[model samples]
Target: MGKSTGFMEYKRVDENSGAVKDRIKNFNEFHKHLNEDDRIKQAARCMDCGVPMCQAAIRLKGMVTGCPLHNLIPEWNDEIYQGHYEHALSRLLKTSNFPEFTGRVCPALCEKACICGTVEDAVTIHNNELFLIEKGFEEGYMKPRIPAIRSGKKVAVVGSGPSGLAVADQLNRRGHSVTVYERDDRIGGLLMYGIPNMKLQKEVIIRRQKLMEAEGVVFRTSVDVGVDIKAADLLKEYDAVVLSCGAKNPRPLAAADMKNTKGIYYAVDFLKSTTKAIIASGALLQDKVTLTNAKEGSYISAKDKNVVIVGGGDTGNDCVGTCIRHGASSVTQIEMMPCPPVERSASNPWPEWPKVLKTDYGQEEAIGVYGHDPRIYETTVKEVISKNGKILAVKTVKVKFDNGKLVEVPGTESTLKCDLLLIAAGFIGCQEYVAKDFGVALSKRNTVATSDPDVYTTGVKKVFTAGDMHRGQSLVVWAIAEGRACAKQVDEYLMGYSNM
Candidate 1:
């Protein structure tokens, strides 16, 4: 601990963010870093307790708490408090492969499980982490670590998302030749498109990609394994293959005539198209400008239209932000479940992933522009009102749970003007084409199925899987953890021993 009594002396100080009104004008990161002095004070708040739950990845009451990567939170907090910037960064990188990515986007499970937060505000673990990694880059400490000798083994990573990137980074550093294949025109699979540019800038992903390339990881964009490149060909050429394809099979809406409606789109498609347009524009995105449409031959635009997004999770929140940035006249988000309590419920005690209501940046921006939170809790889409095959409005109904079944309440039906409807109801599983092509069996959850009692390996030899493809839809931090563990197993299979 930097100072034993520092937790008592200093209070938590979060990183400052730009006002929502000013931030919504452009699609860029708006959260500003804390000054060095204040960052130190925030880090000093870490008590370095003997039982530091911040880094303890534990499962309780069916919910995961703390950092899944099991990061050395106390060690790094002390390093930051003592002004040992490089040491702090080293300690951070020991567990996380992409602290920069997690820093910007992760929900910060570490803070939720923090012992300090049990009584008071938690230490600024997430902000301190962002500061350390960015400091590493600024001070030129983050450089390519090319392997000195070749291991004479080759590995193919069948995705460019977080998990695939982690596998490639780890395997390449271990002297194995690794090549990452992505179907999209650019790398950083979900990171590049699924997430909006306002939350995580495209340049950050590209910067890391360039560094990975410099370190001798080959990236093949627009190459879809099992389609553009045959799965059999990969197995014949490389010693091993790791499938990290994310779970992108979107859950369908049961709205009447939803399929034929011209203004309907998946939440991923909407968010992806907006990011692509923003990146292609080379500046802040403008209203009604079309880049590559999410669906072939169909353009998605929300400018001056009343948009209704289905789902109240992060993806829907992203859609809310994107449509607002596109100048949508009005926006509303619908959730099937009841709104969570403002604070943690008695059933959800400390260190069990606090189930509290959070006003995210998108909600804040929506409230600033529309003068109210756009979410309609305990409600769901009932139908898609359309005319001439175009969406004109959305019908919704309030719902309640009875006998563990969702039942729509009577006399609570309403309709809202909706020129655009985005389905953000979450993913069901991985797309079927790739899994079928690879001859991999699937579990009941529609995820890639491995041999009995053995994960990461398919029934077919020399084939492995990770990330959402293996574990179903999960957090990016979990994807990286899965990738690291899968890489270690793959290394052991190849060399009969491993140190990845």
Candidate 2:
């Protein structure tokens, strides 16, 4: 705890973002960091409750709260308040593999579960976290902590996303020789290509990857384990293999098939192409793609075109923001769920994550540029109207929950002119072919199944699972947790004990 009266004295201040009009010109990170003094003040606002819920990471009444990685929130907050930033970073790195990613992208369950938030605004834990990591970088205190000696045990990590990275980091620290293999050309998985650069700059990921490489973790890219290198090859060479490939199986806007529209594209496909183009150009992305780009709209820009994004999740909002930066004539996002109340409802008490309407950074940008919010709640895209090969417009209908099911309201159909459609619906599970090819068991949810009877093992001998590949699509924090825990299991399998 910093000061008993700190929460009362401080008023929450949001960090600054670039002017909407200016940011829309290109897909770049727009938020400016809070100054040191203000960051410390924000840290001081942590009430340090008797039982701090901020880092509890729980699902209460179907709502999650606090840091899912179970970060030592109050301790770090105290360190930050006392100007012990390096101490705070140490405590933060103890559990979370990447605070920078969470600080920028997470919904901040910790803030919602804040004790002070019962009556006042929650402390800016997320911003303070960003401050700590960036401070570590600037202060030159962030460096590789190589193990004193290698354990002579070899471990293989499949996937290179947050989970696999966390597992590799932990296992490497425990003195095990580790290699992380990624199917993509880059190492950061979703951080590398799935998300837009405007939200998470690629250099941020590269910084960490470089540090990890210096720490003795080998990274191999563009190597598909099931294809380029056989799974049996890893089994023969390594003591254990941990799978962290994220759930890439996108939940179809199965509705997307209804459109039969040629210009329609998946959100990930478009965003990946956009980021690839940006990475290649080293500045604002180009207006076109080379012949090899695999995504729709790789050949075109959203400029001067009306766009309708289906699915009001983060992906949808990202699409809206990207299209805006690309100079979309107008943008709208539709969701099946009804709008949530602004305040916590009675069913949601203190420490429970309030189900509320949150207009994220993207929506804010859209509003600033368009004069109104772009999201339409309680709505669903009904159909897509297209010319011979291009999207023409989108048809939508108002919907409501009736007896636990979505019911379309009568006579609520409406149409809007549209030239492009991006589906931002969430994913369902991991891809099946590779898992099936290895004869790995799958969960009822279609994720790689792990049973205690197998000691956290997959169907194939010496095979293990973690992250989205093991647990389905989830937050980065949870994926990190899974990877960390799974590495411990693998270490134990290899050496009969795990120091993790």
On lDDT, the leading prediction is 1
Pairs that clash in candidate 2:
none
Ten-residue stretch with the least lDDT total in model 2:
285-294
- Give candidate 2 regions above 4 Å deviation: 258-260, 284-300, 452-456
Provide TM-scores for the models. 0.96, 0.94
Q: Which one wins on TM-score? A: 1
Tens-place lDDT per residue, model 1, 1-500, is: 65688888988877667788777776778888888998898889898589989899899988889999999999999999999999999999999999989998899999999988988898889989999999999999898999999899999999999999999999999999999999999998788899888788877898899999999999999998888999999999999999999998989998846567788889899888777766656554444232333343333678899999988988899999888887899999999988899998889999899888988888888999999999999998888888899989888999999999999999999989999898999898898888898899998888999764237888888999999989888889999999998999899999999976
Please give, for residues 287-364, the per-residue lDDT of candidate 2 as tens digits: 422223324444346779898888888888888888877778999998888788987788877777777778887899
Clashes of 2: 0
lDDT of all predictions = 0.88, 0.82
What TM-score does prediction 1 earn?
A: 0.96
Residue 369 displacement (Å), model 2: 1.4
The alpha-carbon deviation from the true structure for residue 96 of candidate 2, after best TM-score superposition, in angstroms, is 1.5
